[model samples]
Target chain A: MSAQSEFDREIALDAADGEPGTYRGQLGEGWRIGGGINGGLLLALAGHALRRELGETSADGIPGHSDPMAISAYYLTPGVPGAVTVRTDTVRRGRAVSTGQASLVQEDETGREVERVRVLATYGDLAAVDGDATTTATPPQLPDPEACVSAAQAPPQFLKHATLLERLDLRLDPATTGWAVGKPSGNGVIRGWFRMADGREPDPLLLLLAVDALPPVAFELGLPGWTPTLELTAHVRCRPAPGWLRVNLTSRTLSGGYLEEDAEVWDSEGRLVALSRQLARATSPRR
Target chain B: MSAQSEFDREIALDAADGEPGTYRGQLGEGWRIGGGINGGLLLALAGHALRRELGETSADGIPGHSDPMAISAYYLTPGVPGAVTVRTDTVRRGRAVSTGQASLVQEDETGREVERVRVLATYGDLAAVDGDATTTATPPQLPDPEACVSAAQAPPQFLKHATLLERLDLRLDPATTGWAVGKPSGNGVIRGWFRMADGREPDPLLLLLAVDALPPVAFELGLPGWTPTLELTAHVRCRPAPGWLRVNLTSRTLSGGYLEEDAEVWDSEGRLVALSRQLARATSPRR
Candidate 1:
């Protein structure tokens, strides 16, 4: 099987085909070196496809936005080589919390199963922050999008050793903010306007994964050999009518080869949508 | 209104005492000032106290030993000084996870409540590790007890701080070896051997709070100035037999004025019995 482009290939939701308690996924061989399909990516894709049956628009339809996700993914297996298929099923859904199981599968020319995973999720209404019934958008003010080149404008770095995030394409409204660097294939803590990079009107879930691609704004403070995220727990703040979203990202605390990053994502209305904290393991690129 | 040395104070275990439906704590003022607590203390207080309730013996039950527990304490509140009373309630007791809620409270002279802390804990089964079921007592192969001066031997930075710890009379076995630094009353991460500075053994419950006296190993790698913690979730691998347990500790990561330190506590038999992880706001002594 070959996957040359997103439009050129087609697959249905794995839940329709597989039963509960079972999973399948591809362990991409060339997916990682510096960049590849890591935990965040897999989680996004699986969560996205699983939404239709849940009576909610994909995490994208939740309104306002940049990655205002209150979810996290735990990496149990590395992305290996090959085309991957993700299967998901509802594990439990309550008024405030719900869980889903996802499995990644890979097959050789003969269609053999490779790697798989099952995830449990818990989500809540972000509308209750600081006693506010609906999430309020009073975030610290940031410069306009046209005034700077956001990390969104940078070409995403897709590592050959791992799964590359080829699905994202970003743009900076200002296209030339001074402090922003690496407009092309931006690397080492992205600074920019962000989006699906595919020109799709912003979706919260898509934004969630996109933000994960960039380093936290705090990282721009200049910490080196940065590696972050063994786990991530995000708090969703506000939701607004969607439009261009801009954010500044930086990295810090490059010590012990392990680090954590915090992000503040806002909406077009300047409302705070979500905040994420990620921890990652530092790995030197194999020369 | 004044708190004298009311050491013999005891409070009945009222199962239904405390405000329900409220989820938060008043972190002690001192633990937030960069350095506070060690894992060995946490283990003794937590593990020993729990064991004692389950019909275990005192510190005198163990003979030759050296178990240094370098652990993590994610600070939720500053300390609650004065005739402190703690209440520990078991939440869940599964084979894989044993959960408990411990609250330390202090009442003002007028009997007004001043501080309260709730710690949710997980004590993993020792069988989870590749070790024997019953704890062994093989002393660590190190110098004789006459060779090294225990951390308790070091001059107390605050002569007054020593008074509180000195009353406990915690003596250490020589085989315990590790590196640690001291923390001022209001600055920096501290580490080193930790036991009751007083030669007398203490009730295991009171002993756990002493770990808050050492510097969190995480602050070593935090940002210049900041300490933030909304919650603390800790896991202890096994239970150390009560006695003078020694722990080798180090400050691990400090970034964004926030730090995280993961520690391990091992007994004289080279068996790992406890571990902890703490998240702190990364802050400099003075900006």
Candidate 2:
């Protein structure tokens, strides 16, 4: 619509010359959470490569199976901004759904290619997914977007390195931002509203990014520092409608030096759009 | 200790003659949900192979990284009871964790080996996992194992085909089993206690099976019939203390003919031992 949003530009892939299944992409700047790129952005990059490898049509010549229904990724190493390659492998091409695996590899300081993330995803037509539709989980109650605290208002030290916040309109619920001022709720829940700054409509692919867009829920537990995600799985339930999306992230248990964060995303129409769960290493605030 | 339990026997893998990464195993009878083997059993089989491939030691020669911390599986096809081969591939061997990929291949009716399940998992030492542990979610309230209705008391039609029930001591809370009597709770939840009939202790690998052992939560929503799992991810948080593990399954949303089932498994110590989330298709009862 407007020369492709920044998100599209960043995740764009060019066909590689040597391999049919390999594609080249660039990790754009301003997406670092700390020393590495955000995990969701890396997942979206691989999802893009997987979609390209699977093509727009299924083996049955049907126009379905074009969207990633569920994708699980394991972060092998932190990703740095630079040139990266995504290698895709088609596992199966069924009539109803198609499955593919993708790996995002980047070169290290020694010029050795290191795998940053490995993913397995299934693609399907969300529109064709018809049957009973019911929702027992409701959207988290929150004030209007304009009434919430903007990411720019976060602690300067945190906002300094998390430049990715500048690219999105992230408004945090004031109740959940207590940790920013040293008064955490201790409930391990983070609720916020997410929308791309460039006004791009969120699709299944973007939902991947939206699922992990929130700051680590551990922050709400007063356990600061970076909580690196080891593995994440996102399920795109349906296509979302345009407008700001409501996101709620919760950590039910924190045990064994690791915690599992679960996210539920609801679209403007109040319909659940995507759900995700990630396992991450828990870290305590620096003494 | 008594002899090996039925589960260990069914999931036992023998070294393949030729390849170093290949192993032979059999899908023992009784673990069938409908026409095929249970998804959890298949996952356990692959996890066993992954543990073998990654070995018991890490690259640092440390005696850790043996348990599966997180494992995700995609069900390719329904597996019948028969001989199956598990092909394992070591993706990486890090100091704290090791990653591996495995595929369970079985002979189809056409005599061609077809991949039944493809899994990507990361293994680590549960005992070595130490950190500031905190949990806000409490275990589900339910009657004692002896007070709950046993799997043997289920509808004869379902019990006849689900021989897997006989192998485990599954006692479902009466409130959530209304679908068996044509009175649906309309709230998608099922709580139960799980244990092996032979009194086998529950380990991380066994927790994989325990995660998906319960009947579909869709049953509580008046939905009947088989709910095949499309993708499942299980996270083992900590080791369990022997006895019956408390399992709670819930379906928060059923949209577009697909529903997500999230499970929280608490051990006898009341500690959260494992967490799992699965995507499955919802089916309505026959007219």
> Going through the candidates in order, what is the number of backbone clashes in each?
92, 0
**TM-score to true structure, per model:** 0.42, 0.96
DockQ for candidate 2: 0.63
Q: Candidate 2: lDDT of B118?
A: 88
Each prediction's interface RMSD?
A: 14.3, 2.5
Residue A114 lDDT in candidate 1? 48
The sequence of per-residue lDDT tens digits that candidate 1 reaches over residues B19-94 is: 3312222222222232332223323333332332322222445221111111112222334433444455443333
> Best by TM-score, which number?
2
lDDT of 2 at A169: 92
Lowest summed-lDDT stretch of 10 residues in model 2 chain A?
Answer: A55-64
Go through the candidates in order and give each one's DockQ.
0.03, 0.63
DockQ of candidate 1?
A: 0.03
